[model samples]
Target: MTQDPVSIEPLCLDEGHALGEFYPLKQQAQAEDFPADPAACRKDFLGQILHPRPGNSVLAWGARMGGRPVGLCAVGVPEAGRRWTADVVHFVVHPDVRRTGIGSRLLATATGHLAGLGVQKMTAFTSGPADGAGAGDAFAEATGAARILRYQRLSLRIGPTRLATDGDTGAGCELLHWRDDVPAEYRAAFAAMSSRLAAEEAARSGSDQVPEDFDEDKVQELYAVLRAWGYRTYLTAVRHRETGLLVGYSALGMADSHQRHASQWDTIVLPSHRGRGLGVVLKRANLSWTVEHEPELATVTTWNAIGNPAMLHVNESFGFRLDQSGARREWTL
Candidate 1:
C-alpha cells in the first residue's frame, strides 16, 4: 500500500520530542565521524538556541510521516541588518525522505520567514559530505542563491618546508608583525586596514540596532573578552616597513591550541594591493613567527572559496589543503 506524502509547517520551540528527534540528522549532515553519544548532538543544537545574544535565533520546520518526523529543516539568524544578510546556518532532511522535495519545501518556507522579517540576503555553508558532494551543490541550484565566497582546506605534515615566493615592493608595501606594544604612528593605519578588511567582507562596522557609542573601544573590549575565555591567538600583520603604510593582515586563531589543529581566519589584502604576492609573504612571515614562538603546533588549517583560485594558489604553495568546504545557498524574497 502506498502512503500519502507528509505536510510541512513550522514547529514551535515548545514542541518538544518531535523537534529533538532531528538532532541525529543534523549531526550526520554536519560532521564526519560524528560522535555516537546521543548527548553530543543534543547538547550542541540546544546550546546555540539558548546562547544569549540579541539577534540569535533558531527556527525548526518539518513534516511528519506516521506521526513521526520524517523530514526536517532548520535556519538560524544569529544577527541581521538592512545591507546585511542572515545565514541559513543549518538545513537538512531525514535520510529516508531525501531527494523527495521535502527539504526544498522546508527551506523555501524558512526563507520566506526571513524575508518577511526584512532580510535582504541569506547564506548557508557546504562542505562535501564524508561520502559525497552533491547535497549542497544541488540545493543551491534549485534556490535563488549565488555563491559569493569559496574556501579550501589544507594539511601540513611534520618536517614540511615553508612556502616562499618573490615579494612585491613596487607598491611601497611590506609586511610587519604587530609588537607587544603597537607603534604610535601605525594606529590610524591599522584602523584603516581593519575597516577595509571588514568592509570587503560585507561586515558593517555597526548596525542601527547597535548603540551609537559602539566603536573600536568596544571591539577591543570584545577581543579582551575572547582573551579571557582562552580564545586568544594574538596576531596582526601590517606593512609598516614600506613608508609605514599598512596593506595586508591576517588573524591567527586556534580551536584548542593543545590540539594539533590551529587555524587562520579574517585574512585580507587590499584590492589595489592584490597581485603583488604580498599575501604569500605575509603568510610565510606569520608561519615563521608561529613555528618559532609556538613549537608545539603541528598543523594549521585555512579555507579558500572553491572559486577563488588566486588565494588558493597562494595557500597551496604553503601546503594548505581542503579541510572543509561548505556550499552556500539562499532564497530571495
Candidate 2:
C-alpha cells in the first residue's frame, strides 16, 4: 500500500464549513502547549477570519492527506505601511506526522506567498515549559530561522493581594479607569503616549522600523476591532492633575464573559515618569479593575522580553509566576 500524497490549499473563509476541517488540525497542533477551549477558539478563529483588524489581513492554508487536514499555517500581513514585514501567526503539523516533510512544505508555501507580496522579513514564535525545549523551537532551528529574542510567559492567579494597595501617582497625578473605550478627554494623550512607547520599543530592539502613526482615529479603530473580536478591554492610566496629560497606562483584555483567563496587553510609562512606581500603579489598577468586572476570571497571562527586567520585576511583585519560556525567530527574505 502507498501513502496518499499531501495536498495544500488555501482555507475557504467564505463559509463556516471549513472550520470543521480546520479546527481539528489546530487542536491537535496546540494540544501539548495550549489546550483547546472549543467555544473560545471558535470565536477567535471566526473573528479573525471575518473581521480582521483595520490595515491588516490574514491568509491561512490547510494541508490535507487522505482527504483530511493534517497541518495548517496562517500568516498575517499589515496591508499598508509595513507591507515589507509579515508574521507566521500559526504553524502546526499533527503530532502523528512529526519528522515528516509536511511542516516544511507548509512553511515553504507560506514563505512563497509572503515573497510574492514583497515581504522582506517574517517572524514566528515557539513556546514551551520554562525548562524544556519544544517541537516549535526545533522546527524553527531546522528551517534556519534566526532566534532573535527570548520571552518569558507569566501567569497570575487572581486573588486578594497587596497589589491593590493605593500608591502615590506622584503628588500632582491622578488615576483614571475605563472599560471598553478610551474617554474623549484622554483620547489624544493616550494616542501620543502609545505611539511614543512603540517607537521606544522599536529602537530598543535595534530595528529601524518606524512606529505606526497612532492618532485619535486610529486608537478608536483599534478598540472597535477588539470589540468585534469578542474582547472586553480594561484600561488604567495616570494623568497629570495640572497638565491633563496621560503619563502612563496599562491594559487587560478578556475574550468573553465566560472566559476564565485574560491577557495583559501592554504596560507603559513615559521615560520622564520612570522610577515613580507608575508602572506598578498602572498595572495594579488595571488588574484590580479587571478582577472586579470579570467575576469568573481566574488567571491573567503576560509576555515580556527577557531583557526587560524592569517590567519583569513589576509582574513578579504582583505574584505572576513563570509559565513558559519562548523564542521569537525571524527570517529575512
Top TM-score model: 2
Task: Report the lDDT tens digits of candidate 2 across residue range 1-333.
Answer: 677889999887677678566766666666655663223355555566556666778888889999878888888788865787777766878887778899999988888888888888788879877788778988889988887768898998887664466566879999898999898778888998888867765655644445656888878888888888778899999988888888899998887534688889888998888987888888887877777787777788898887789999999987898988888778777
| Count of clashes in candidate 2 | 0
Q: lDDT scores for all predictions?
A: 0.57, 0.79
CA shift at 274, candidate 1, in angstroms? 5.4
Task: Quote each prediction's TM-score.
Answer: 0.62, 0.91
- Candidate 1 lDDT over 1-333, as tens digits, reads 676767887777765566677666666654532232122235435433333123446676777777667666666664555324566545666665677787778777877777778776666766553345556766777666665554445555424356233233454555566422234555555556666654544432122222122234444543444443344363556574546667777666543223444567656677767887767777766666655556666777665655456777888876675545554454555
TM-score of 1: 0.62
> For each candidate, how many residue pairs have backbone atoms clashing (under 3 Å)?
18, 0
Cand. 1 Cα-lDDT: 0.57
**lDDT, candidate 2, residue 268?**
90
